[model samples]
Target: MAQSGGEKQGKLDFDESRIDSGIDSYKSISREQDASSDRSQEKEKACVTDERLDSAYVSSSLNVDSLGDIIEQCSISECESATDCEYTEEEVNFLTTVTEDGDTILHLAVIHEEECFARQLIDLFSPELMDIQNNLYQTPLHLATYLNLPSVVKGLVKKRVSLELQDQDGNTPLHVACEQGFWDCANEMIHNASPSKLSCVLEAQNWRGLTCLHVATLRKHHRLMRLLLKNGVDLNLQEGTSGKTALHVAVELHDAPAVNMLLNKGANVDAAMFNGCTALHLAVGRQDATIANLLCQAGADKMIRNMEDETALDLADGNDDILALFPFDDIQIMGRTVMSFS
Candidate 1:
């Protein structure tokens, strides 16, 4: 208590330095604990985040795999049973190619006569694939007609498939049905087609300029020809290249029934080919006396010659009926008449 001024000042300075050092040490220890706690919290947070991410990834992957598996199972089961199975929108949309030639499932189902499968597929994905063309540029209806699947044709018609759709050869469904002798299919098409579409069906020609009637005649489908004629198919419509009528096709094929059908339908027997040879010429060349008589009765000109100046009599190949039927007076009259007309 009785120290000198200098001693007292030195003692006070020592106490202050000791207090400052203790304070610095306390702050350093607190700083170290805070750093350690922060590291632990960061690690815990990282662990939780990693666990959540892993769980989400697994859930997503499982969902995708499950969907894929369901689709594969459904397709396999349906195909094996040869029947259509009920499927949701998501199920039918599963990836499946049906055609061996890159046709869609709908196309294959329709063409192959898989009724159930076609129905199921149509109900699901028809809006998307109904209009899709195959590698041959054929629609589902085209394939259906080609395969002569009446049920499939009816189904497609029920779904309102475009009747005017054409294939690569510019053939409509009616063209195909008629060409393939699918009379019922042609009837279905005729019944469902609109008035404006009727002309297209009647007038649809193939690469050879053969209408539906020509096809029916070529196939000797008399009933189909009658149906087409009843629908107002032009009996005199000539082939574009050969200029041959339905009558000509019948005579060429020697199809007596078809020829009779055409003649009965008012087919012009006298309609000449490009070389001015009538159906009688063809019938006579084939030695078909019955057809020759039928054409003669139908007013076929016997004296008409081809580009080689050979008449049906000359081209008769020694058929006595032709030689006997063509009387000399009638021959002279026909020649004079044809010459006068020419």
Candidate 2:
């Protein structure tokens, strides 16, 4: 199924005009499923509760799979049944039990995409359980967003789970979603987020000092890039470690389309990175005529120099097409100072 006639992330080739309706339907399915699943769960809650087999409990980072298997086993009976009988203190404790790597049962549920069991756990546990951070410092909400499970995402959101909490690497759920190309999840996180959360989550950076936009660009997620831009992200924001703007990434990767899109969206064509390398310099160096043309068309200043004091013209080498974007006489102009320049 195509979404907008464009092949975005291998999803349906849908038409841009249909985007609103398509997303509306897409989101509607998630909501409808959640509602029906909730009602079905209500019916099960009235029935008998299944006890976790003793084999289901374990305490080992190496044994997470074993725990995941046991929980998968329990999910079969518990998630489908409506038994209201709550978890025993010991079972609850087991639910909260963390491996050396710090994953709770809730984390596993989201990982396995066991939506029913996950929601049931959410219903039965204290709100604090949702906030439990694993060894990676990812809360259940983070796991759900990273895993791109809408049901689990909504379950956490329904509880008003904290959205602004940063992981060990300093990424909020928004960063995880954007970085991983989970567009729908990103939308859900942003749409449901409070204004304060929107600010913090959008601005939050990972260890590399990359906002969600940087990751989106680095990963070539066109749709995600638009979503972030539509949400009012700072386009000129450079990577903390690399000091490269999104345009620099597109040009370096030889992604002409991304270069065009970023330029249209207001990415500074002449913006420099950590080494002071601008997109124009990268485009010329890469011999990407299309991107070089796009940059020129967008009014990229060919006169800008990197820290190495090299302009796009100086690095064009034998690529006459790239060399042509500059003024015809610029070479002669640079020649007078070329010896002193390099």
Candidate 3:
């Protein structure tokens, strides 16, 4: 049974050769698998690039369609008289998307005074775009106020469009209505807006810390001023930065009507400004003798001084008539009191 040692060793060598051949076969399979993995990764990358290209193409085509639609709409006069053509729901929806400055169809329709288009837009797209803000942070209500379209403003308010919406400067629709002197739009806002919402409108300050009253006074809009004052706006409210009251602005603007309105509304005639200058001082320094007489008649103190301690007479610059308005006892005119000036 014991074979020769050389024959047994030869059998062992043959078994080792078989094991080495199996190992070489496994290595070749692993190399092929790695190459296949690389090819699959390349195919995935190609797919991503193709998808991006397809997206670009689709976007380009949509842009072309949008431009073409705008051009066609401009050239055609059929839409001018909205009664001539009835817009389908789909067509109205499309118009809603092609907005100028991010405004919806309802916004443009109301602004352009297109009564028929506005009605159709409200009937169809109001639920979708009623709350949309244009690029200028103006809602349809704000636009309506700016354009003095009371009908559209009423319709939007009746539909319960947001009255509390703010623009970029945090101004409400009422602010726009008041600033533009649109009494009808202002009335609509005041009537339909809630008490809390109205508070925001009345108190809402622009970037200049000016409430609606401040704007009305600056523009010398007497009607708007009366409307705001009647609506409970503070008559003596001072600007946050300038500490100037509506009376001060009225005096500066030389608007006799606005000044009288403010004075009658119980505005402080002698309220000092940021620099400690009163309306009387401004009226005198600017040579507004008429406003000066009004201020004096309203009991504005002639001795009111600025931060530099200069009185209204000090600012009169030798105007004898202006110097005579102040009681000589109250004002030191040329180092003398009323005894010398009169």
Candidate with maximal TM-score: 2
Residue pairs in clash, model 1: 84-116
Candidate 2 — which residues are off by over 4 angstroms? 1-100, 124-127, 166-170, 329-342
How well is each residue in 150-175 modelled by candidate 2, as lDDT tens digits? 77887687777888778877888878
- For candidate 2, what is the lDDT? 0.68
Give model 2's TM-score versus the native structure. Answer: 0.68
Clashes of each: 1, 16, 2
lDDT winner: 2
lDDT string, candidate 3, 1-342, tens digits: 224653321110111111111111111111122222334444333222111211211111122112222322431233343334444454444555634346565555554445544654454445447878866677877777777778778777777778777777767787777677888998887787677767766776777788888887887778877778888887888888989888998888889988888888888888998899999889998998898988899998887779999999898888777877876545676876654434
lDDT of 1 by residue, 1-342 (tens): 224553321110111111111111111111122222334443234222111211211111112112222223334332322223333344344334333344565664453345555665554444346767765667777877776777767767766677777777777888887777889888877776666777766876777677778878888777788888888788998878888999989888878878888888888878888988789888888899888888887877888888778888988777777777676643346446433211
Q: How close is candidate 1 to the true structure, as a TM-score?
A: 0.63
TM-score of each: 0.63, 0.68, 0.64
RMSD of each: 28.2, 15.7, 24.8
In order of lDDT, best first, we have 2, 3, 1
Better of 1 and 2 by lDDT: 2
Q: Candidate 2's error at 325, in angstroms? A: 1.1
Query: What lDDT score goes with residue 30 in model 1?
Result: 15
